[model samples]
Every structure is written in structure tokens, then in C-alpha cells.
Target chain A: MVLIGINEFIYVASILFLIGLLGVLLRRNTIVIFMSIELMLNAINLALVAFSRFNNSMDGSIFVFFIMTVAAAEVALGLAIIVMLYRQRQTILVNELKQLNG
Target chain B: MIDILFSIFASLVLLSALAVVLNRNAVNSAMFMIVSLVATAGLFILLEAYFLAILQILVYAGAVMVLFLFIIMLLDVDKGENFNFKTRKLSLCATILGVLLLLALILNSFSSNNLPSVELFLIEDSSFIDPGAFDNKAKAFGQLLFTKYMLPFQVIGFLLLVAMIGVIVISKKPKF
Candidate 1:
């Protein structure tokens, strides 16, 4: 009998967030790290939606709408940057992306 | 019934989230992320946020994820053979940190729901809404967004315009 509560949702959000953090830290590839960042943002979205439910307000829901918009913009820009990086460096690994130091 | 729906979707979200991290291939990770996002939208529906649930499916699972797949295939980015790692220390640390964070969140959730924000919203709403009236949530949010949040909304539009220009300018190939 899995009794789901608001706390269950919170716990799920926290675990997903930690997974995102580890993914960012452990993965060396820039694409993988970028995916991890998206995962973290999704976790935030989950928490916001859950809080909006319990708090009985439209504010958090509206906030999530804006967050979604910002996320779309971020993906567009980030993918462009990734494409440019690959063209310039011939690789997408984060460990090898220090061309700015020159 | 709701609890069952939540459990199923939540499990799907967790499994796909783990897959996004553990998969060696970036393409596979992106695919898994789409699954995770879809399940997240399902959870939003359970929470009765209909508009957000639909937006999550449309924007995140549809548009954004397709963009991810496009970039991945276009870039031809793949992981190399140097993939193995010493999981002993890192996994242990991550497990400990995760457990601690979950514990803190669980404890906080179990306590009373007397949060200031909750209280404030209750006062503003002034009465318990009928379950049939949940659709009104979207209406209220739309109204507030257009009125009180209008300025920020306009700013975000401008920000998106700027970001578009910046990306094109930055990614443009410089001629020698």
C-alpha cells in the first residue's frame, strides 16, 4: 500500500535533483553535462508544481510557465553554442574545452 | 486512485532520470530525458495543474527535446572508450549526500503545513474551493499573469529576442 502524499512528491524531487547534481559532476562530456542541467531544471519544475498545489495559489503555476519559456530559450542558445564548440575544437568533451585560456 | 497514478508516474520519472545519467551515449540520454519529462507532466496533471501539464508535454517533451535530438545528431558527438571510472568513492559520497538531502526534505514535509506562503494564499482565496472548480486555477493564473505579471512577461519576450540574436551572432562562422 504505497500511500502517496505531498511529502512523497518532495522526496522524489530531491532525489532527482541529487541525480542531476551527480550527473553534472561525474560526466565529462559537455552534452551529458548539459542534459544533467536540464534534469535539474525539471526537478525544480516538479517542486514548484507540487508547492503550488499545496499552497493553493496560482503564483507557482504561473512561475512554472515562465520557467518553461526560459528553459526553451536556454536550450536554443546552448545547442548553438555546443555546435560552435564542436566545429572549433572537433570535440564536445568538457575536459578539453579550455580554448579560452589562450 | 490518485495515489496509484502518482506512484506509477513518479516511478517512471525516477527510472528515466537515472537512465539519463547512466547511459553512456548522449543520444540515449536525451531520449531518456524525454521520457522523464513526459512522466513529470503526468505528475503535474495529478496535482491538478492542467495548463502546466499540457505545456510541459508540448514545450518540454515536444519542442525542447526535439531540439536536443537535433543538436546531438547534427554534432555527431559520442562518448569515447575512456569511460570506466572508480565508482567506489564517488558513488559512496553521492549516496550519503542524497540520503541526507532526502531525510531533510522528508522531515520538513512531515511537519505542519503552516508555511507563510500557504497561509497568505489561504487568506487571499478566503474559502475552500470545490473540487469541480479546479479548472478555475488556470483562469486565475492567466488573469494574474496578464495583469500583475505583465511587465515581467514583456521583459521575458525581449530577453528571448536578445538570446536569439546572441546565439546567431556567436555561432556565425568567422571568415578568414
Candidate 2:
């Protein structure tokens, strides 16, 4: 019964992470990939909070705070870049942005 | 009880994440991503980190995802054909790598001695029955952020400010 604790959360996080990884690997849309990355971050946050609760330590929660801050920052920058790319190419397809491949 | 709830949310999160990736329309992907984020936040609540779970909903699902959707809406990306990898070999390699990583993670988890164990903190003189009501987690978090992690916190704030400025500069039309 007690086994339904932190390990369960870890399993959930791992599944989310795997899904995100597959999204990043298989998706061609830049926006979708970015969303997957956000998913990955959320998965990590779940693990952090779960461990924090199980260990009775506040540090993991604190880490989640910082992670959220960084994730917000990342979203801002990432969207800005995506917007710029869309302006230049008129499409958000990851495969279409091969101008830098030279 | 907890396991059942956890499994349900986990499946929902994973499914939404897959939909986000597989959906052809960028806006639809963003919407599914929002769903996934919300489900992840629910899982966080189940983990007893109520403060974090609320923050997750507020920040990621609410603020960040909205920002993403706004950008997608503003961009008006054409419904182009989905991009497929040029070489099947590359995708095959990626799949193999993914499977190997998954296998390793499961094996490592089983082999580790750090299996999950709950530690009960001794709460003296606190008669609060609702853990959510007595939750000083956010307060304690703020204190630590301001004291020990203050510099890093300020750095991140400054970085966000810079990013905002950069976006403005980039998006502005030339006056000339």
C-alpha cells in the first residue's frame, strides 16, 4: 500500500518524459517540438515535487520554483525565435528552416 | 486509490503529449499541449505539493501555454504538409536509441536501493487538519529564494527582462 508513493510518481514522470522525447524526435513542427520540451520540463517538475514530499525536504519544491522561472524565460525566448522564423519563412516547419545548413 | 489516480493522469498526460506532437495544425498541438500541462499539474497535486501544483497550473498551463498559443495565432502559419524525415534510417536509429534508453531507465530503477520511502516530518504544536491550509511551503520557498538563491533569482528576472526587450526590438517594424 505504501509502495503507491514516490515510485508511482517516478513512473508517471518517466512516461511523460518518454512521450516528450518521442515528440521531439518525430515531430516536424517547431511549435509542437517546443510544446514537447515543455512537457519534459513539467515531467521533471513532477519528479522534483514528489521527491521533495517523500523526503520531507523543502529543497525540491524550491528547485521547482526556480525551474518554473527558467521555463517561463525559455518559453518567452523560444516563442520570440519562432515568431521571427515564421516571419522570415512564412512556415513553422522545422525541415523548412534549412537556410543555416550551408 | 492513489495508484489508480496516478495511472489515469499519467495516461492522459502521455496521450495529450502525443496528440500535441502528432497533430498537423500548430494551434491544435498547442491546445493538446495545454491539456497535457494541466494533467501534469494534477499529478503534482496528487504528490502533495499543493503549492507547486497550483504554481504549475498558473505558470505553465495558464501563462506560458497562452503565450505560445498567442504567438501561434499571431503567426498564422499555413497548413503545410507535415514534414517527414528525409531518411528512414535516421528515424530508425532514433527509435532504437529511445528504446535502449527506456530499457536502461527501468533496469536502473529496479536495481537502485533508493526505492521510494515516505518520511514523516514531526509537526509540533500544529493543530491544522488541512495540510493545504497550513502549507507554508510557498512562504518557506520565498524565504529561501530571497536569501540563499537571491542572486540567481535576480539573474533570471534580469534575463527575462532582456528577453522581453529583445522580442520587442525584433518584432518592431522598421520606421525607415
Candidate 3:
């Protein structure tokens, strides 16, 4: 029936991760970088679930909880930092954020 | 049966992922990211991880994406049309590099032998949730989370509390 095996999921995850990587490297918007980071995290989550199914273990699924928690924390802190930066700098563009580049 | 569903969701996830990167507007990127998230959650359901699927939709697509949109609107960050993230030459280089990396990953994947296991074995005495059943995945997930993974659960709770304080601290106006 469902023949999408474990490695296929991994391949999908890797491609998503690479896409996120490209976004991070090529896109200069801080928000886009944050979104890319989330994309990468989701890719890891996919791999974790796929492996859990393949191994018949619930441990991998449990890891997803931890990952999501950390991701939430990251987003909270990251957005706060962005907001703070915007208050000081007036723009969210990455190219203009060079005051601290000593 | 399930394969068809999986293929559909997987492609949608990838498509929305591309939208997240390629869309010029921050709001559009955030919305497409939510689409990608829900699709990935659907794939999780196809893997019989019903709890994770629900959690994915609820936590990520629901709570997290909302926060993203809130931040985007609060700052008025996308008022004007701005497009140049990098020079065209740099973007071209990045595209070529990313494609090369993808090709390498796909080619490398074909030659490897996959792990040889598929039978699900549940922890003994966890009676309510049958590991192989179509339903009750949440029970198994809760059982594991409450028992074997209790420490991490509590730890994550503490992490959330600290993160809340940190966010408030980071966003406050500096008193000079």
C-alpha cells in the first residue's frame, strides 16, 4: 500500500533542508532568515518521524517535542531581537545593519 | 492508498517551501510557510504519527505562524517594495551551488542500503494505546511523554518559562 519507505522521507527532508540553506544564504531579509531556520527545523522533524517509524521506536517522536520547544524559544528570542533592532535602526533590512560591525 | 496521499502532501510541502523563499512579501512568505507546515503534518499522519501530525498543525501552523504574522504587522516592515537581497551574480552562484548540493544528495541517497525494520513493538504494560492500531496514537504518545520522557517534559516547561522572560527582557526599551 504505502510504499514511501524511510529513505524517501530522508531524501525529502534533505531537499527541504537544502532549500532552507539556500534561503538563508541568498536572502538578506532577517524575517526570511528566520523562516528558513524554521524550514530547516521542520526538515529535521520529518527525518526524526521517518526514522521513528522505520525503527518502531517512539523515542524519535519524543525528540520532536524537544525540538518544537526549542524552536518556540528560538522564535521568541529571535523576533524580540529583531524588534529591538528595528526600534534602534528603523529598518529590518540586513544590509543596513552594520553599526556593530567593528 | 496512503502512498497517493503522501505524494500529494509531500509535493505541496515542497511547493510551499519554494514560495516561502521566493515570495517577495514577508506576509506571503509567512503564509506559505504555514502551508508547508500543514502539508508536512499530513505526511506525519501518513506515517501513523497522529499525535505529531496534530501537534505539527496546532503548534507550528497555528501558534508559531501567528506569531510570525504578528511580528510582521507590528513593525510595518514591508511598507515599501524592496527586492535586492543579494547581487544577481551572488544569487546565481548560490543557485548553482544549491543545485549541485541537491544533486549530490540525491545521487548519494540511491546507493545506500536502508535500515531493515518495520515491525512496531510497544512498551510492555502500556495497555491503552496499541502501537499498530489506526487510532489511539495520542494515548501512546502521552504515555511515553508522561513516563519515560517525563524529565524532558518538565525541562521543556522550564525552558518555555525562561524564554518568556527573555523575550520580555529583550523587547523592553533601554533605560539610559
Candidate 4:
């Protein structure tokens, strides 16, 4: 049961992370990609808290808090950028935004 | 019992995640993302990190994702049919890499000999364990955040403030 505990949590976290990665890679819409990124962050948070619990320490939870803070800020800035891009191009398709390619 | 619950929550998280990715509309994707976040929060609770679980729901599912929905509604984007899952060569490569990574993680996890037992972490003190036991999680988390992790906590606050200012500066319409 001891080994199973760690294996279980790690398995869940890895699967979540993989799903998020697939979403990021395959999704065409910019907003969906952003959502996938959020999924990735949550997966890492799950892993962190799981490790912290396994070790009986509070440090991992603290790190999760900080990660959450950063994620919040990231969403704010990222969405603002998306809004601006929408205003300029009138489309949120990832492949169409090529103005910065020059 | 825990395994059953874990399986339920894991499937919910994964299925909602897939919906978020495969949904055609941006709004639907955001909604599915919120569901995935909430299910992930449930997993956090099962991990015994009650404080992180609450924060997960409040921050991710509540505030941040709400903002995503607000923006989606504000933009009033057409229900465009742009969602595509067509696999290219790169996707196949990514899939192969993902499978290899999963195999490596599982094998490596098995090789590790010092994995701690769940019983070791289970709350044994019935006196300290009650319906309100998790209520202390936030207080304990706060104490640590303010003491040992004070510098990093403050730094995160500052970072958030800076990001807020940057968003305003970037998004504000020019008057002149």
C-alpha cells in the first residue's frame, strides 16, 4: 500500500499533464491553448501537494500557493494579450496570427 | 475506498480536459476547463492538502476561470467551427514521446524503494481529527506563508501587482 500510494498520485498527475500537453499541441484556437496551459499548471500543483503530503511537510503547499499566484497573474496578462490580438486581427486562430513573423 | 474515489475524480478530470480541448467553441472550452479544475481540486482534497484544495477551487475555478468566461462573453466571438484534431507528423511524434515518457515514469516510480506508506501520513490522533480538522489547514498554511516563506510570499504579491499594472498599460485605449 505504501508504494501504491505514491504510484497512484504520480499516475494521476502524469495523465493529467499528458492530456494538457496533448491539448496544447493539437488545439488550434488560442483560447483553448490557454485553457490547456492552465490545465498543465493545475497538474503540477496536484503533484506538488501530493509530494508534500507524502513527506509530511508544509513546504510543498507553500509552493502550490506561489504557483497559484503566478498562474493568476499569467492569465491576466495572457488574456489581455489575446484581447489585443483579437482587436487587431478579428480572429483568434493560432495559425492566422502571423504579424510577428517578420 | 480511496481508490474508487480517486478513479472517479481522475476520470472526471481527464474527460473534462478532453472536452475542453475538443470543444469547438471557446466558451465551452473554458467551461470544461472549470470542471476539470474543480475535479482536480477534489483530488487535492483526497491528498490531504485541504488548504491547497480550497485554494485550487477558489483561485482557479472561481476567479481566474471566471475572468476567462467574462472575456469570452465580452468578445462575443462567433460559434466558429475552427476546432480540428487532425494529426500531423508532429502530433504522431508527440504521441510517441508522451508514451515513452509515461513508460519511463512508471518504471522509475517502481524502482524507487523508499516510497512512504499512506498509513504514515494518515491522521492517527482522533482528538485532533474531527469534522473541523480541515479548518486548521488554512490557519497552518497561513502561519507558514507568513513565517518561513515570507519573502517568497511577498515576492508573489509584488509580481501579481506588476502583472496587474502591465495589463492595464497594455489594454488601455489611448486618449490622444
lDDT of 3 by residue, B52-105 (tens): 888999899998999999999898787543784677888898899998998888
lDDT per model vs. reference: 0.78, 0.76, 0.84, 0.79
User: After superposing the true interface residues, what Cα RMSD does each candidate give?
Assistant: 4.3, 3.2, 3.0, 3.5
Each prediction's DockQ?
A: 0.50, 0.56, 0.59, 0.55
Runs off by more than 4 Å, candidate 3: B79-81, B112-136
| Candidate 1 structure quality by residue, lDDT tens digits, B86-114 | 24677577668777877777777667762
Q: Of 1 and 3, which scores higher on DockQ?
A: 3
Top TM-score model: 3
The residue-level lDDT of candidate 2 at B89 comes to 73
The model with the greatest DockQ is 3
Worst 10 residues of 2 chain B by lDDT: B125-134
lDDT of 2 by residue, B69-150 (tens): 8987887764675454435776787688778878977886788674745643433323233322223356666666777778
Sort order, DockQ high to low: 3, 2, 4, 1
* Runs with alpha carbons beyond 4 Å of true place in candidate 1: A1-3, A99-102, B79-81, B84-96, B103-137
lDDT tens digits, residues B25-104, model 4?
78888888988999998888787777777888899999999999988898776455444754487678768877888888
* DockQ, candidate 4, vs. native dimer: 0.55
- Top model by lDDT, which number? 3
lDDT of 2 by residue, A1-102 (tens): 433666667877887787788778877777778888988888898888777767656677888888898889788888888887777778888777788899
TM-score of candidate 4 on Cα atoms, chains taken together: 0.87
Docking class of 1: medium
